[model samples]
Structures are given as C-alpha cells and as structure tokens.
Target: MAFPILATLVVLIALATLVPLSRRTTWLVRDLDFPRLQIAAVALAVLVAQLSLLDLRDYETVILLAITLACLAYQAWWIIPYTRVFPNEVKAAVSGDRDERLRILTANVLAPNHNAEGLLALIREHRPDIFVTLESDAWRQRHLDTLEDEYCHAMKCPLDNLYGMHVYSKLPLEDTAIQFLVEDDIPSMHAMIVLESGRKVRMHFLHPAPPSPTEHEESTERDAELLVVARSVADLDTPVVVAGDLNDVAWSTTTRLFRKISGLLDPRIGRGMFNTFHAGIPLFRWPLDHLFHSKHFTLAHIQRLPAFGSDHFPMLVELAYDRRHGATQEGLEADAEDEALADEKIAAEPVSEADVHEPQA
Candidate 1:
C-alpha cells in the first residue's frame, strides 16, 4: 500500500516538473511554472518517504527515487538564482544622490476590493515618487484621486474589465501614453520621467492577462505582450524601468526570455523572492508582481508592502540612477535562439489596433 501510494506521488511530481520544460503556451503547461518551489518541496518529502519505507533492493524503487531526485535538482536550478546562494545580478547602489534616486510602488487593487482607505494609507505612508494601480475601476480611481495634489502627474484608465490601470507620479511625466499591446481590453503604460537631477528615465507598467480558467486559455497573449515590450527596449541607450503585475513568475521561461531580450536587471535575483500574490495564502505564493530595470540603475531598496484587502501585496523599489556602476553590472544577453523564440511567440499572437490615451496637461 505504501509503495503504490508513494509511487503515484513520485510520478505526479515528475510529470509536473517535466511538463513545464516544454515550450507549450497552453494554460495546463504554463501554469505549472508557478509552483516550482512548491513542487521542489513535495519532491523532497517524497524522496525522504521512499528512503524510509521503500526497499533499495527493488529496481522500481530505485527508479522512483532517481526521478524524485531529478525533479528536486531541476526545480532548484531555476529557483537558486533568486536566493542568497547565488551572486547578485544587479549591483547594489553606492551613491546617496537623492537627485538621481527614484522610488516606485506598484499594486494590483483587485477590482472588487472596496478597502481603498487601506491602500491609500500605505501610499501616504510610503510616499513613493511614482505609484501604479492595476485592476482599477472608476470607484478606485475616485478614491485615489485624493492624492493628486501630491502626485501631480497622473494617467487614469478606469474600467470594470479588470485590466484598467492608473499611474500617479510625483516626478514630471512626458510622452505618457496608454497602449493596448495585445488584447484591446488589456492596457499597458509608457512614459518618460524627469528625475530630480533633470535626467530622463523611461518607464513601462504592464499587467498582462494570466493563463487561468477565468482569465486566459493560454499564455500566448501574455508572452507576446511581454516580448513585444522587450523588443522595444532592446536597442535603447537610456535608463529604463519596467514594473507591475506581469501575471507571470520571475523565473518562468517567458519572463526569462523577456529579460534576455530586454537586457533588464531583476532586483530580486540575489535579494529574495518577495512573493506578492495570494497574500492570504502564505505557502502558495510566488512573485507575480515584478520590477525590472536597466543596468544604468542600481537597487537601493526593494520590499513587499503589506496587503490591503487584495490578493497581491504592493511592491516597492528604490533605484539610484548611477551610470558609474551600470558598466560593472551586465544584463542577461539574448542569443540568436532567444531572438527566434521571441519572434515566434510574438508572431503567435496578433495584436489589434491600440487605443492610445495621452495625459491631459
């Protein structure tokens, strides 16, 4: 009885670990990418159970143990880079130049959540230079509007469709545009921010649809949106920061490809996972909200803010625009194969005409 039960568990773990290795865009395959850490934990437990109960003399037991060990190793390979065991990909900031520093806060305020006051209190306390909200509707917009006096530059796109976004910035904004990259209903924001030192920094906020039974059938649209943005920034020479709820994990194949293609540095690489989603479920959380920036900027601080009636906690990051350290830090370079994969993913999902909304002066 114990052998059969353990064997079934081992096979299931092996399947979950192997299926995500494929390049399938379907939800069933891609969604498996979210729980690598959880899967690794289960594999470890199963391996221990086999060692305790299963006979080493049997070949079947040996094979099951080998499969469990392989799954553990595979999952750890993808998760270790984000742990302290690995070196930092993005260098830490050395300079204390307040003029060159920029602080950003991004949150997904779950459209149905009515605890606007809770989220508002966090913004008031943190006072981020720029703050963005996803799944913002007219009700959330009205409540957030009270902060306009402090955050003078703002862009609001309120909708009940669960993809609406609003960005409020204390810094001056230029060429701010709201664009629908893939699906017409899903919106992403692009803008140039004028730092205190008068240097210009480009910013992008994205909240692509997730691959789930309720949201999307597959991750093709989400991957396409991410890659399209990655291609846009691949050749740029200026400082860039991309943030928001990507609806994907930091270590997922699509996101890894996005980083390789865009040459953006992830602050969480050596710091921590800083899982933001499913705030209610501590054990089942992965990083869904991400902030990726150019090498021109170094991380000052990154943290996950407390939840405010939403499934996701807000992510706050302070970056110092120091070109001195930028040359020392190298972003992940995309190979020819990466380029081909990106092109293929982008081509799989055709984009519709975008509705561009510019901020009112």
Candidate 2:
C-alpha cells in the first residue's frame, strides 16, 4: 500500500512539474507554474520516503525514484534564481544622492475589504514617496483621500470591478494617464515622476487580471498586457520602474519573458522570495506583487510589509537612481526570438484605445 501511494505521488508531482513547460496559456496549465517551491518540497519528501522505506531494489521503485529526482531538479532550476544561492540581478545601492532615492509602496486592497484604516496606518508609518492601491473602489479611494494633501500628485480610477487602480505620489507626477491595455475594465496607471533631484523617471503601475477560473479562462489576455508593456519600455533611454500586483509570479515563463523584453531587473532575485500573496495562507504563498526597474537604478531596500485585511500583503521598495552603479549593473536583453514572441502575444489580444482615460492636470 505504501509503495503504491508513494509511486502515485511521484508520478503526480512529475506531471505537475512538466506540464508548465508547454507554451499553453490555459489557466489549468499555467496555474501549475505558481507552486514550484511547494512542488519541489513535496518531490524531495517523496524521494526521502522512497529511499528509507520503499523497496528501491525493484525496477519499478527505481524508476519512480528517478522520476521524483528529475521533477525536483526541474523545480529547483526555476526556484533557485530567487534564492540567495543565485547571483543578485540588481546591485545593492552603495552610494547615491538622497534626493535621487524613490520609495514606493504597493498594495492590493481586495476591494471587498473595509479595513482602509489598517492600510492607512501602514502608509503613515512607512510614508513612502509613492503608494499604489489595486482593487480600490470609490469607498477605498474616499478613505485614502486624506493622503492627497501629502501625496499631492494623484491618479485615481476607482471602480466596482476588482481591477480598479490608484497611484498617489509626493513626487511631482507629470503626463499621467490611466489606460486599459487588454481589457476595458482592467486599468493600468502610467506617468512621469519627477524625483526631488529634478530627474524624471517613467513609472507604470499595473494590476492585470490573473489566470484563474474566477477571473480569466486563459492567460492570453494577462500575458498580452504584460508583454505589451514590456515592448513599450524595451527601448527607453531613461530610468523606469514598473510596479504593482502583476498577478504573475516572478519566475513564471511570462514574467521571465517580460523581463527580457523590458530590460528590467527584479529586486527580489537573490534577496528572498518575499512572498506577498495568500497573506492568510502560510503554506501556500508566493510573490505576486512585484517591482521591476531599469538598470538606471539599484536597490536600496526591499521588504514585504504586514498584511492589512487583504489576501496580498503590501510591498515596499526604495530605489536609488545612480547612473554610476546602474551602468555597472547589467539588465536582460531580448533577442530577435523574444521580440517575435512578444509581437505575437500583443497581436493575440488587441487593445482598444476607446477605454483610455486621461485625467485633467
């Protein structure tokens, strides 16, 4: 009985590990990409059980062990890059002007959650130069309105839908625009932020729909939205920061493609998982809220803040715009193959400009 159960577990684990390797965008297939760490752990546990308790001398047992080992290795290949065992993709800030520093906090407020004060308390304590809230309806927006006096530069697109987004910043925000990239109801914020040092930085805050049964049937729209943004920023010469609840894990194939196309560096690499989603679930959590920046900046600090009545915990990241260190740090460059894939993704789900909203300055 134990041998049969272990063999079944090993086969299941191996299937989950291999299924995501396909280019399929269906939610059922893509969802497996989220649990690489958990899958790896289970694979290791099964391997141990087989070695100590199972009859490994049997050819069937040996094959099962081999499959489990291969699954574990495959999962580790994807999970290891986020661990300290891998090299840090974004260099730590050594020396930079204080005025050049930009602190940002992003949270997915879980539209139904009414704990606005709890989130407000976090903002007061951290006092991030910029703060973004996703799933913010009119109620959440009104409660957070008190922040406007300090966060004078603001962009709000409050809606009843779960995709609503808002960005408030102390830094001067110019040319702000709220655009719906893939879906008309889903909103993404874009703007030019003027740092205290008078340096301008292009910023994009996104909260694309996730590939889930309740949200999206397939990952096509989500992938297209992300790749569209990636291509838009790929050739930029100035500093850039793209932050929000991207609804995709940092290590997923789509996200890896996004990095390659955008030439952005993930701060979480080599630091920690900093898992921000499933805030209430200790065992089933992954980093969903992400912040990626161009090589024109280096990481000063990155932290996963405590949850405030939301499924996703907030993320705070302080970045220093120092061209000296930024020049030294290398960013991922996309090849012709990557460009072609991105073009196909964008073309799959064409975006309409009819839903774009530009607030009056």
Best by lDDT: 1
lDDT tens readout by residue for model 2, 158-199? 999888888999999988888877888988998889989898
Model 2 TM-score, 2 decimals: 0.96
Give TM-scores for every candidate, taking all chains together and pairing residue i with residue i: 0.96, 0.96
Residues 1-361 of candidate 1: C-alpha lDDT, one tens digit per residue = 8899999998899899989989988899999999999999999999999999989999999999898999999999999988988889888889999999999999999999999999999999988999999999999999999999999999889989999999999999998888887888988999999999999988889999999999888899999888888877775778888899999998899999999998899999978899998999999999999999988898899889999999999999999998887778876899999999998998888852132232222
Cα error of candidate 2 at position 246, Å: 0.9
Worst 10 residues of 2 by lDDT: 352-361
